[model samples]
Target: MSVVWYFDFISPFAWLQWPHIKALAEERPVTLRPVLLAGVLDRVGQKGPAEIPAKREFIYRHVLWRARQAGYPLHFPPRHPFNPLAALRLCIAAGSGVPATEAIFDWIWGQGREGDTIEALAPVATGLGIAEPAAAVADPAVKAQLKANFEAAMAEGVFGVPTLSIDGRLFWGSDAHDFALACLRDPDLWEEAEMHRVAHLPVGASRL
Candidate 1:
């Protein structure tokens, strides 16, 4: 089985799942697909966590705590809510492997480096020994690839970063990794009859 990992580099929570995904790669094929979280929110008619102050605060602490628990280093960038277009494009340009993707994640979230602009990202790429950072980011092919990635993700029912899709069954959020792993181990758990039954269940009275 293969796991399609949909992610955006700007998300700290997405960064938290990097290590877990690497671990899972040892067991099965894992493809890292870069998608714009802004595009996802737009398509799903939802606001990002950072757009809600209360949730944003909670997310920061929660992600940090989770990272600590997972023994992964995490530091929020000095400025958040920055456009990750260039970085996302860069990942695609670099072939979206574990090394290149993790390098992008490490520079942005791990070391708290600024990567909002191509100028800012150039140094990070240089540090990672990536050639032609400027050309890579500016390439029209990279831009097209990123757009295609976003569109494909939307078509697959992805509404957020760090989503895992195994044979069209989606498991969203960093916390859902364990559940996705479980699903992978037991493909029979996706009982269609039970799912149809739940889907047709009558709704209880709403408190509202």
Candidate 2:
């Protein structure tokens, strides 16, 4: 069983999920499925968090509180409503080596101005031995990979970032953590959960 996490850089909930999501991988392999939240939102025709100021702030504070309880350092990012695709692409490319990705993400979310450009993401990428700062951002292959990842996520019924999928069942919220753990521990539980999810869904939704 694998857990594929979808997240947008702009999401504080994703921020909340980051620390605990690792637990699902202990003694097990959890794949990080980074996808563009904006891309998923496009298919769902939903606006991002920035559009819902009051609701976003409410959710942000709640998630931040959870992060604090989880012992993660966090602060409201300095730049509100920022674009994170450039930053996210680096995370996807970094794959298992997401220390740089976490650093940049934490720095920005901890009230830092690190999301200004793809140029800024390069230093983080270079430090990770993945690519030169300029090369990764400029490379068409990186762009295409990011785009493809987003598309695949869309196909998976992923409508947001920070989504975790296990054993082909999609869990949309941080609150679904327990069920995710259950799916990871038992293959039979996974099969049961998969059928439960499919049974609830309407016709035409296929696993992607």
Best by TM-score: 1
lDDT of 2 by residue, 14-98 (tens): 7777766766555567777566777788789888776798977777778778878877777775666777777776775566334
What candidate 2 gets wrong by more than 4 Å, as runs, is: 93-96, 187-208
**Residue-by-residue lDDT tens digits, candidate 1, 91-142:** 8878888888988999998899887887888876776666888888789988
> How close is every model to the real structure, measured as TM-score?
0.91, 0.81
Best by lDDT: 1
The Cα error of candidate 2 at residue 83, in Å, is 0.5
- Angstrom error of the Cα, residue 65, model 2: value is 2.1
